[model samples]
Each structure stands twice: as structure tokens, then as C-alpha cells.
Target: MNENSHTMSERPHLRVVHGNPTDEEVAALVAVITTLNTRDTPAPPPPRSAWSDRRTLHRPPLPHGPNAWHTSTFPH
Candidate 1:
């Protein structure tokens, strides 16, 4: 055997096996899948916030001119 060659015993052995489900098993599987598919329902809408009322959502107007900063009490 060459230096780079590997013996049959040293090589990895792999095998794949395929299966066929019986008719009854396939029908049961389909029934389960269909049940799962039909169980999904649309979620309910979220509740409205407390600030949803326009009357209670008031905010003071912002100051705008050069002297506006002097009129305002809040620090920049």
C-alpha cells in the first residue's frame, strides 16, 4: 500500500435506511398536521392607551425668537 493510502478497515463505514409509512400511519399523521394547521387563530387587537383622549394630551407651545430664551424659565 502507498504512504497516502488507507486500508478498508481504517475507512469510515456509513449506511442510510429509508422507510415507508403504512396507510393508517400516514392518515393519522395527516390528521395531526391538519389539526395543527387549523388551530391558528388571529390575535386580538391591543387595548387603547390612557392618552387616547385628545383633550388630555395637551403640551405647551415651544418658545421661538431670540428673546424667547429670556422669557422661558427652563435652563437650556
Candidate 2:
């Protein structure tokens, strides 16, 4: 054998063997994934018919200004 061949064999080698995952391991992984997928609860809906009476009680004459005749292009 050559001197170079001896040096090549001195390097370390690793061998890894993996087996099938267990059912409990799969269940735990699924639980973690499910937990991550879950989101916070949405805010509750606003009260229905709120300020309905106040809207009807409003009675005021709108002031007609010089710019009032010009239609407002701004969106609501």
C-alpha cells in the first residue's frame, strides 16, 4: 500500500440508522402543529341598533357656504 492510502483510512466515518416513528410521537407532533395553527378568538360583534334613536333626533339646517355648491369629491 502507498503512504497516501494509509492517511485516507485515518479519517473518521459515521453510520446512522433510523427506524419508523412511533404512534405517540406522531400524535405529539400533530398536537403541536394543531396548536400552532390555532388563532386568537375574534372580537365580539358591536351592539345591534346602537344610536338608532339619536340618529332620528338630529334636526339642523345645513349651512350653504360658497364651496358648498361645489360637490365634494372626497370619498366617505
Best by lDDT: 1
Model 1 clashing residue pairs (backbone): none
lDDT of each: 0.70, 0.60
Per-residue error (Å), model 1, residue 19 = 0.6
lDDT of 2 by residue, 1-76 (tens): 6654535558434222476777887678678867776755566887868567586686554546687545444322
Per-model TM values vs. the true structure = 0.31, 0.32
| Candidate 1 residue lDDT tens string, 21-55 | 77787678779878887788666889878878785
> Local error of candidate 1 at 63, Å?
39
Off by over 4 Å in 2: 1-19, 40-76
Q: List the residue pairs that clash in candidate 2.
A: none
Q: How big is the positional error of residue 36 in model 1, measured in Å on the Cα after superposition?
A: 0.3
Worst 10 residues of 1 by lDDT: 9-18
Which RMSD does model 2 reach against the true structure?
Answer: 13.2
